[model samples]
Target: MKFFNRLLIDFAYYLQNSVAYQQKRRFFYNLLENDEYKYKKYFDICMIILIFSSVSILIYEVKKDVHDYLNIFNSYVISFIFLIEYLLRLWVASSVSKVIINQDEYSDLLGREFDLWFVTKKILKEKFEYILSPKAIIDLLAIMPFFHELRLLRIFILFRVFKLFRYAKSFQTFSSVLATKKFEFVTLGMFASIVIFVSSVLIYVMEANDPNSPIKTLYEAFYWSIVTISTVGYGDVVAVSKEGQFVAVVVILAGIAVLAFTTSLFVSAFTEKLDDIKESKTIQDISKNKRVYLICGYENIAKEVAKKLLLAKFHVVVIDDSLQRVEDAKKDGLTALNYNPGSIESYAKLNIDMSVQVKAILCLREDDVANVYTALTVRSINTDVFIMSLLMNSKNRNKLIYSGVNEILYDKEFVGLVAREYVGQPVAFEAIHTLRSETSAIHMEEIAITERILAKYPTVEKLENIKYRIVLLGVHKKSSSKFFFNPSDDTELETGDFLLVIGNYMFIREFNKHLSHKGEV
Candidate 1:
């Protein structure tokens, strides 16, 4: 049965590809599908503006003498756009479903195919499924204005305005927060219900027998109880007797307590959920980032490195396999995500494209295979970006080097070095001084030399005539096996060389800026 099932699936996929779709499937897919395609934002913004205008028109038409000859024409225009959007969305669904079923888009290597009925049935099935989806239902509702003329029906059509919430990330976060804390919401609701029932029964028994009582029946007493508890005691219902008034006071106090507790719960949930939304958006916004650090582990060493980078006021994103560690990183005010670091989807989930400004990636996993795999993946995605891998075993060093890792830090060597430095262990506190300060006289910076800077400062010897108060420590080049440590004054400075310099931080900044802006350094 499994074999036959696979056969049928393959046949259907092949058949779907044979059909001639009328519109540009890829074009409509990017424009209307759920994924954030290139043009999707602009398309969504335009649709939202159109929806708001339509809703405003509906509200205006509700007033007396507001209807004009253009009103009917305006309704037609809005309905037409909604209809186009709905149809386009359906087409997008069909295209996506077809593409999903057929990953390779196999050509006629073999001259066999399924019948037309098979393909039609599969395509129509997908369309039917999409029509029942929540977004599709919203799209359809946006077009109901043309189907009816009744004022009451207009209210339902007016709800089309709510479709705007699909684009509102904060509102979506609030809904998700509510879902996550549904137990708390239910508990609060049950508690309020119990209070309402007890208060209603008490007030009814106390005031129902009185002929002049405003709360004359059980139903009226229930209404009065609710109003009193909510602090909205409408004059239509009230407690006339002193005994009834005492019960009213108790209900008001309970209501205040319940409402305050509920408000606090909601506020806490909102804050947490809002932070989650902001973190996700921050990842998305990094596509425009000119330089960012992508740290690929959440271990102690990775954490320390990330802290140093962040202290230098650099943007850093950490990816790890453990969800708990990712959350911990986020709680520590660090940007982190959970992903299978070896997967292509993980790279895509970095929320960056090839053009993104990626300064470097840190592969600090203890697993040599995982580190090498990540190095290869990052290298495939970006050829120029630096990849620094931590060697778990000496034997894997050559493997990582072959994987295009720009640098390797051997763990054993570092551990040995740390062991030797045990005498000055308290010197760890000196790192705090590295944090930039406005009053600090000296700061270290790695300034990259470009072709323009190389034209003037052709060699280290030429830099001595400069009046800028700075000291050159060393130059690191990707093409070299080791850094050129305090090279001779005549050593040539290449275009891609990185300069290690110490000076007044502001002066260093201005000097690098000048190098970047001109033909001469």
Candidate 2:
């Protein structure tokens, strides 16, 4: 027995820490998200609807005098599907991937390879644990039609309603709140049960022998007690005797107190729950965004850049260490996360690595070390992601460059450059001012020759027509790492090439609108 137990423990270790286990976990979690896998989400939604409909049918069957064969057939069909789902879930536990990496168990089990006995043990462990899981139990009860003797199992069909909580965030929050306050609720329940019982007995004793009493039996007295305590006293039941009337008054007063206390508890819990739901909604919104401008620091420069980005109709996600700055950003109508800006863990929490939607990350920290460190971390996660850093001192610009920052803006030098431009040409300064404002009709925009643009306009000359009064400036090719300035008409456009064009704001909007609608607009 000891030898077998040791082997089982080793098997459980591999099963729990395998690559397939983590992959399956991610797959299921992503399926609940709207933007990740649409088909999987649809499958989950269909199953939830079917489960609820099945329960409703079972309820209908309970009340119907005439038995419907169609209902039985439908139940069988749903059960079969559920059975398949259950089996699939169980099968996924013994994942196909044999190797595990970067896990805590990897160090201890370094030299071991998967063999026949290990595989068998892992499979057994998976099946054993899954059969004991809460979802599996619910699934089993849902398909209890196969066993006619377990008619009571139909009561567990109500668990189907709770399965919706897995998909709906609001429902999940509500359920979590209830679970968190279960102890308090249970205490209140016990007190209320005692109140009802005591009141019922007193009313029964006081009014059982009265000539004008509507309450006679224990059940009738209990019903009267509950109705009176609930403050919904019907005139059909009343206490005729003075003693019974006094008891009724006391019960009414107790009901008022109970109602007030219960309402307060729910209100208090809901207030906290609202904040949680808000954060969850923000994460969901982030997940749905196709691209966002990620601002690392919440400094003045960061704020200005974020405002411009927002005005340009680009989604912006701000990460700040200071809670006050995060709140300020939130007040300004930007989605802000409060955490360590330099930590990759913070980015992970925001699902940065999981999303290809981070268009650019702007490091606006005054501290050079922080900026360099953060830029390196961002590049490590996304090699192709564009990174721009704001430099308080020109000397630290190389630090940012060495850390793989794509662009470095010397804030001090910018002040002198602005003065130079303003001294020579007022119109040039105004043009720049208008461009920075993000609302001017004439602005500079960079449109990449993505696959979509490649399909629409294959060459540089093909896109030089300027239908909306736009100017073709230059193309920044990713492969060459150089900008071709006004090349010949034959200069071809390729994927990853950024077309720098100074055009009317409306013209840029037209490109986005046409591309999005495939020229429908």
Candidate 3:
């Protein structure tokens, strides 16, 4: 018992510490539950196909006999797959080993004996909670048709259709909308029930004595009431008496009012959720890319930057709290989200930490406070992601830096400096401005010296020889974090160094392609 206990503890510790194990677990978790996972859509598609096929087979069997092979495949094969899905879901729902390890660590900290029974109970409690969850219950029921020996349990084969709710995000969204209006729905339900009950009672009382009336019993009257309220008058049941006809008219009017109310409620719920659904789709689309520029504000500067990034073939996602700004970004043909940049929940919703695709975060909110908060929130979620923010006020520069802003732009100060420079060198300033602006075909671009580039061109002279049209203005060294202006030909190029080059946009593109293909330009 002692040996077995020790082995179990060691196993739990291994599970908690093992990188490979944790990675595998995380992959499974993402595959099963993470909507932003790259392969989740494919997984969902496959599951949907299986569900439809299984349900189709079940429905087919209802009217006619199925082949023994088809029956076996549906009953055993699909059920087996569902059984595995259920177990995997259960496994990912909560970590039993994590709970065990936490308990063991707590026991050690308190200098007490490890309580196996306590850990067992806690694990059981978590598993039980998961098992009782609506999705999990559906999963369990979906697998019940495997036990075909029990003829009564065969009806559960239909529950496989409900499994679509798990894979279809739209269904979940609809369910969420309905969940939010629970109180209103409950009130509507109560009112509807009262109307139905009263209508049924009145119809039964008025029609029971009338020999010509089709509703002879309370059950029949209840059925008639449902049919009438639903506006599906089968014409099989008729109220011959005037009193019965009056009740029917009243019930029909109430049904129309109830339906109108229900329609209004659904319309309002969906209207409210429309933005959220769009945002979710935008996030999913952003997640599909392996690299994306995250712009926190959809202001003028941010919009221009996003456009430039998009033109450069880089994915860009604009996020702002202002709905108008988000809408403007959408209008401008950009992926945008209406989300609070300062809120940690927004970062989590974007899956920033989980996604290595976020190449950089640009906080360009006009408000200094909002920029600082956004910087802080992003830094907390992702430490290594490059962050740049616009410094509206000079005084907040230190605060922005402390909040983990890698670069800070001062619009006023920059403009002032440019104005001063323009006074001294009007022609030079204008030429530079023209080159930077959209009107000019010439553009400035940075080319990073990757391992391939470093191997091919070890010196500045070698790189310059590769392309004559492109001018190597300066080299930004990653090591010293400084730019070497007009470096000598003998200057050594290294990995992580960026070549600041100026050329026509087409020339730059050709130069990059030359570097990539390792061929003569």
Q: At residue 130, give the lDDT of candidate 2.
A: 76
What are the lDDT figures for the candidates, one per model?
A: 0.76, 0.75, 0.88
Tell me the TM-score of model 1. Answer: 0.59
Looking at model 1, residue 420 earns an lDDT score of 67
Error of 2 at 25 (Å): 9.3
Query: Looking at model 1, which ten-residue stretch has the lowest summed lDDT?
Result: 103-112
lDDT of 1 at 179: 78
Q: Itemize residue pairs with steric clashes in candidate 3.
A: none
What's the CA error at residue 62 for candidate 2, in Å?
8.9
Candidate number of the best lDDT: 3
Question: Per-residue lDDT for 29-98 in model 3, tens only?
Answer: 9999998687988999988998888888888988999999988888899899989889998999999889
Q: lDDT of candidate 2? A: 0.75
lDDT of 1 by residue, 154-255 (tens): 565565777776666566666778777888889999999999999999999999998789888899989998888887777788888889989989999998
User: What is the Cα-based lDDT of residue 428 in candidate 3?
Assistant: 95
Residue 438 of model 1 has an lDDT of: 38
Best by TM-score: 2
In angstroms, how far off is 391's CA in candidate 3?
Answer: 4.1
TM-score of 3: 0.75
